[model samples]
Target: MAALADAEHRLGRGLPDDLRQLLLECDGIIGHTAVDTVWSVEQIVAQNLLFRTDSSFAQLYMSFDALLFFGDNGGGDQFAFVQTPQRPDIFVWEHETDSRRWVAGDLRDYLGRSLAEGGDAWYQ
Candidate 1:
């Protein structure tokens, strides 16, 4: 709870309720081949900050100010929550094409799909 609160403080916004509950229960979720399907509270804060402020990213891709990144596919693509409109839906930020698209309905749905048989590229 302290970590979550700290994360929220650092990010300047509250995370989704479902995500907060999950993080409180466990530091993070690990999936196939030991990948961090859902990142820990610390990583969540770090990664989001990096994406949002990295100078190179600013030139390479669209502004990340509207997204709250939380996980990665072990490939380069990442998962995030839409912060612009503050929805429960999760979206994938494909690094290659700079495309952002809906993937799961919420954190629960994201876990089911990402941890299933298809390995890390489940969203693909």
Candidate 2:
């Protein structure tokens, strides 16, 4: 929980409650084929900053003020929370297309769906 707060403080925004709880339960998820790993708190901050600074992700940079990257498929596609007022929707950023698509309404929904589908490949 402290880690999550620290991350939110660094990010200058509060993360969704469900996400914070999930992180507390497990720093990250592993042993899943569809998702290589869910990032740790530090990794979330670092990856977000990396993407924010990289010119290659200019499309994402131009559109979103902040993105909380949580997971990645081994292939480079990423899963993240998009900062939005309505709800912080989970989005899948396809590396090949350099495009992001809303995949779930919130963290809880995303988890339910991901588990129902057996893995993150359902998004791909």
The lDDT values for all models are 0.92, 0.73
TM-scores for candidates 1 onward, in order: 0.97, 0.78
Best by TM-score: 1
Q: Which ten residues in a row have the lowest lDDT in candidate 2?
A: 59-68
Could you tell me how far off, in angstroms, the CA of residue 31 lies in candidate 2 after the best superposition? 4.6
TM-score of 1: 0.97
Could you tell me which 10 consecutive residues in candidate 1 have the lowest summed lDDT? 115-124
CA deviation > 4 Å runs, candidate 1: none
Distance from true location, Cα of 43 in model 1, Å: 0.3
Cα deviation in Å at residue 14, candidate 1?
0.5
